[model samples]
Target: MTLAHEMAFASPQITAYAVEATEYPDLARRYRVTGVPKTVVNEHIEILGGLPEDAFIEQALG
Candidate 1:
């Protein structure tokens, strides 16, 4: 799904927060993010690897 579509259905008005690994070394360590494709959503939902567009959005939205 497109980011636009995800935004369309998102609650709490939908927001995306992005932080570079270097910017938050502590968080990176806690999350065990060693690769480039890791994705963590809301700090609770950790998607360890890349996924298809639809699947990624589904997880984030949930």
Candidate 2:
């Protein structure tokens, strides 16, 4: 989540959101979020767990 905020801060083109699964049950179901720290980029790229900064950037922007 920190990396996401940092990336958003670094690039105007990037936007990040942090959602609590317990709070937003419908959204969690929509995204099929089975774990914490799930990252969905543009509603297409679904990253299911924690990732290194570089690797995350590559997948997100590659």
Candidate 3:
């Protein structure tokens, strides 16, 4: 979540969601999210795993 916090600090326009571990089960099952730190952008781009800031930004914005 800290990464997300940092991102939010870096870009005011960046949005972040903090899905709880309990709620994650449902979303994970529904979206086939099978990993920690998975990031979904606009509900279309589902990034499967953790990534560095620049790489994550590129994927999210590119």
Cα misplacement distance, residue 25 of candidate 3 (Å): 2.3
Residues 1-62 of candidate 3: C-alpha lDDT, one tens digit per residue: 67767777789898888777457688877766767777777888877677887887788776
TM-score of each: 0.60, 0.93, 0.71
Ranked by TM-score, top first = 2, 3, 1
lDDT of 1 at 48: 58
Q: After superposition, how far is residue 3 of candidate 1 from its true place, in Å?
A: 5.3
Candidate 2 differs from the real structure by a C-alpha RMSD in angstroms, to one decimal, of 0.8
**RMSD to native, candidate 3:** 1.9
Provide the global lDDT of candidate 3 against the true structure. Answer: 0.75
| Per-residue alpha-carbon lDDT of candidate 2 for residues 1-62, written as tens digits (9 for 90 to 100) | 99988999999998888888999999999999988889999998888789888999898775
Q: Which candidate gets the maximum TM-score versus the true structure?
A: 2
The better candidate by lDDT, 1 or 2, is 2
Per-prediction backbone clash count: 0, 0, 0
In model 1, the number of clashes is 0
- Candidate 1, pairs of clashing residues: none
